[model samples]
Target: MEQGLALLLALSLGLLQPGHGQPLHVEPPEPEVAMAVGASLQFTCSLACAGGAARVRWRGLDIGLGAVLSEAGSSVLSVHNASLSATGTRVCEGSCGDRRFQRTVKLLVYAFPDQLAVSPATLVPGRNQEVACTAHSVSPTDTLSFSLLLGNRELEGVQALGREEKEEDLQETEDLLFRVTQRWLLPPLGTPAPPTLHCQATMRLPGLELSHRRALPVLHSQTSLERPDPTSSEPPTTTSPQATPQQGSTGTPRTDSSTRTCRPEIHWSLEPVSWELLCEAACGPGMTVHWTLAPGGLAAYKRREAGAQAWLSLPPDGSRTEGFFQCRLDPGGQVVSLYVPIQKVIPKT
Candidate 1:
């Protein structure tokens, strides 16, 4: 009992402080932190006791491209745009009252694209057009997968484009960036079909699952053509073989030059209180725009502009909602959609 009382007295007298090899009570107490490339990173190291004023310094940040701010009893290390090369161990040292302490943090970094890029959002019926989808940069290739979907059918996307690398991005890291791509020959669009194509990217982090999806409008392009007979006046064209594609089986569908030129784009903006997602798709004269959620639920408040452009306005809760905000255009056959994925992350220790 006397020994316990003596220890209490020592603590009350401020005679004890963090010693060498001990932690300095860092703000982000997690043993490690995982951040996306170009993300903002900040952490603090602090020490306080009766052993004079505390001073802290950070080590192992030469490649981090960050700055350190030291205060009376604390120090903060902040990196505005974290580089992939900066991922590694970071150390913080604190000293006070002739006593010194140290702590270490592990930083994990990843590269994931914001959008699931799809090519040829719209297409003419009858042409065997090659469709492709791509994700720009990805690291830790084994943890990521891409699925190309047509209606309910799913196909795996290949890393056909291979790796796009830089000398400085990896330095001595085991994970490197890669460009994933896949292509397919558009199949014949049977009548009354939902011929939509989707490119979905899925990433499995330590304890988080991230997904991004983009869809293409119905672009069926398979048809047969035959010369019209001028010799017989009694409807010679009706005797030809019936066309079965969306453009009809009798002949090739006439395609508009404007439809081929129109591009699909999604402009996303996040503000303090609310966020917006705008889709600029080319819907020609026969197509119309529709908005819905992928899992079959009420979508965010939306408005369509100029018959081809659509906007989705989320609630003013200042929190990002997770799911796919879809914008689609068709003549009402339930086809072609562009997905805007809003992610919500609950970091795991």
Candidate 2:
């Protein structure tokens, strides 16, 4: 009877020990978790035992950040407004009967910028000015960069002035606020249209990156025009008449005095031209030459490179030429020539 009581007591003592026959299991068996800044993360710890109900509590081991713990049925730890400093180890403890259980998990957080902004929304034209851009609420501030864009073109020579960091106290936690500023000198504007400016902010890490962009309000400026000089005197020129031979019955020029003088003007230009020297090619990735003269007449076309001596004759079909071209028209023994230089097309990166 004594041996039987001892055996029963030993068995009861073993049963009273927590996790004696059952183990503690934590969800997300992987020990580490990664989360983005300003995001939320949750960790659940559960206990399974042949014994009775267990008491559970969650705690952070490596960091002092506060997390929400739910212990009604299962223990859960929830972290909000995660930041780079929030990375650490978390522990969950459970007690059942006279035994204790614990589990550990690791956390990792990534930092990124929140937004981009431009100061002095409107930029004035034709004035030497400076424009400022800011990257707001960025983490890992040293990795943040700012760029400026006018219309769709990226502005060159933009410089980063400086950066500052401030400590912000939130309702639940404290955060580091980083602001980066960049400046660019605005060129004089000659167009009446308002220029659009874009501020771009980028944050880069080993394997993570974030970007944000914001556009400034339309720029306004006063355009100055040159006034005419009233002290200058010049004579206005008059157009002369051109002689047109009277047509006979057979549509031939008559040699009589009835012939009259008629004036006809000739001008030359490219079909499509712009102030810029750059032009799109007519063929595959090459430069094309085009020259045309107004008032269709007997004309000839020739082309040659700037350094080349020989000029190549072009067919009258108005086909694309490879180099600089010139069109000549002979009317009344007066010859007129129009030259057009072909600009090479540059490939964009």
The numbered model that scores best in lDDT is 1
Off by over 4 Å in 1: 1-23, 63-66, 96-100, 118-133, 140-142, 148-177, 182-197, 206-208, 216-349
Counting clashing residue pairs in each candidate, in order, gives 7, 5
Cα lDDT over the full model 2 = 0.47
Candidate 2 residue pairs in backbone clash:
242-261, 242-262, 242-263, 243-261, 243-262
TM-score (C-alpha, index-matched) for candidate 2: 0.37
Range of the 10 consecutive residues with the lowest summed lDDT in candidate 2: 223-232
- The residue ranges of model 2 lying beyond 4 angstroms of the native Cα positions read 1-38, 43-84, 89-115, 151-153, 162-173, 189-194, 205-208, 218-349
lDDT of each: 0.55, 0.47
TM-score of every model versus the real structure: 0.43, 0.37
RMSD of each: 20.0, 23.8
Error of 1 at 210 (Å): 2.9
